[model samples]
Target: MGCTDSKDNLTPEELAIMNGELSLMYQAYQASDVDLVYRKYSNDGIININQWQNVSSKLKLAAYSAPMPPKIQKFYDSLKAENKYKLRDLLVIGIYLSTGKSIDKARLLFEAYDENDAKVLSKGDIQQMTSFIVEVAVEKTCVLIQDDDPNNVQPEEMAKFLQKLRTVKNKGKQELCKMFLGGNPALTELTMEKFVENVTMPSTVQLLTFQGVRKFIKKQEVTASKFAALTSLKKPTGPSDPKAELPKAK
Candidate 1:
């Protein structure tokens, strides 16, 4: 079948058939894959009122779904009627419920968006959001593995251990040190791959997909590089007299 730029020419029957196609395009667009929409139709004019209604219905269903955590359920119930359906508000709460993130943290993530405006994210915004999620995941995994609290170490001690891990050049050595610090026999055999899996498949989330796994790995590499630079800066020089070396040059 041929594609058209305008939906005004299509009859109701045609619109019904096209609804499925439009729905998929809309979903992809919502997911930050606008390239797919452009490749297919090159414009948003084809979407009809029904598609908008469908999206709203789906969002409502997702937002009001049962078996939510008590905290989330209470928060949702507490929203004023007008605020309940607000896109940014629902989305902030939705992310908190879906990712097991604190509601305040999720709200902070969405703070860039206006409270009354529709929550439309640009490509750059999506990239920033993804980076934030990956950073959070990496930090959470490192903290879990370190288990610094049980050892009677202060929070600063745990931070130091993580700093030390970042400086370690060998991935294997990092994992070994993390395990030793954690003092968990069960995690003694845990590898980097296992840590990645654990972060991607937390108890509250089913699966984060290969993209999440890849991002986790890439984030770790960047973090290590950053810390390596800092570590190099703090390296001790040999016990040579700086004055002797400077005077010899003169």
Candidate 2:
């Protein structure tokens, strides 16, 4: 469980690459420049984490959905903890422009950080991001899944779903990802309505402890026997498939 070193402890070579370089990282991600972001973070092996780990495929999707170097760099401190705890301040900056649901969750999560204020996630944020992310994943996975059996994902669960998709071999996971995306807990009827019908609401509920979901996914297929064993009880479906898989490990 020991970590290597904090970003502060990085050598001059590393520091030159990462210090106060968030905007550069964001630009790299926006342009979908994998190599640039990779060079930036390949310097740091830190795996950004969150509750979405319960489903492996979901997490993988988020990482590859775009170059998330800024998100990775910002969440560096919090996601590095040996235990499961969220870094609210870190999430706000990266997720604000992420998507609407993500923005909403980020707002609520940020509010929780500022518990005295009782702030919440915004409606407009969720709708926009959902539309953008889903449109992308559906387009990518639909073509890939049929031809090469790639990850078919819906936007709502994209973040949570991809976070966990990185654990094992991407091959087997591809075969089972449809079930994963299909089994997605789904945005609530009310939440889905907002993005679908463009209804408006003031704020939405954001679960605090629920952020640990990704941690749960890493353990889903502890072993092949257990993987099959667990299913004996209720005929478990394979792990959830994120819309896409991460190029990096979570």
Candidate 3:
């Protein structure tokens, strides 16, 4: 009838064995031996299997978005006109142009449902997704200039903001400053129109914008998991495999 501490449940020998086993398991997990981690932990209620699967999937998708090699680019350019226009095909091409990565790689960045699945991506999906990303991106830049204020950023404030971004190359930073501030001695303020007009590299802007948007999306209570699920497209079979190519133009 005596109470015993949890540690007291195990003998010294049993505790030593458990400690040693846990150490090895920790090492394996740290090393990212996913297979081993899953094999050992899957049955234990301690593992969040869905989360682990998602993390693994995202990592794989990240690899796909990496820059495409020259060979892949050349092959992509040679695809027939018809093959070039399919939704998935166009997405690959768009990603290639945007990120300089092969479609196979870029495909991982979006949702990966079966092409045959009736859940075709709508124009609304594309528009909403792109708008969400760009808005988030622009909002982030706004935050850098003025913390959470909805008012337009002043010229001097914009200049100081750009100056502080010294980590960016001098040429690029100056260009960005000029773009945002314009070249007029009398210029007093930076407007949203000027901001949009001066964005020299829309692609770069979009990419940077996507990064911020992704974080924001992930933080939203309701949309967080939904966004992740949306981006989870069916995995591309292979970059160069013809069999994996999007259906030829109708």
Best by lDDT: 1
Cα lDDT, model 3, residue 15? 32
Candidate 1 backbone clash number: 0
The C-alpha RMSD of each candidate to the native structure, in angstroms, is 20.6, 21.8, 29.6
* Residue 20, model 2: Cα distance from true site in angstroms: 15
Minimal lDDT window, size 10, model 1: 204-213
lDDT per residue as tens, model 3, 1-250: 0011255553332233223222211222222233333334333222243433443343342212337334333333343243322233223222222322222222322331123333333333333334433332322222222222233445565545334332232333233233334333245443333433333244323232223222223234234346668889778667877766679788
Of the pair 1 and 3, which is ahead by lDDT? 1
TM-score-superior candidate, 2 or 3? 3
Segments in model 3 whose C-alpha atoms lie over 4 Å from true places: 1-102, 112-119, 141-156, 159-250
TM-score of 2: 0.20
Clash totals in order: 0, 35, 9
By descending lDDT, how would the candidates be arranged?
1, 3, 2
| TM-scores of the candidates in the order shown | 0.24, 0.20, 0.22
| Alpha-carbon deviation at 121 in model 1, angstroms | 10
Lowest lDDT 10-residue stretch of candidate 2? 204-213
The Cα error of candidate 2 at residue 86, in Å, is: 26
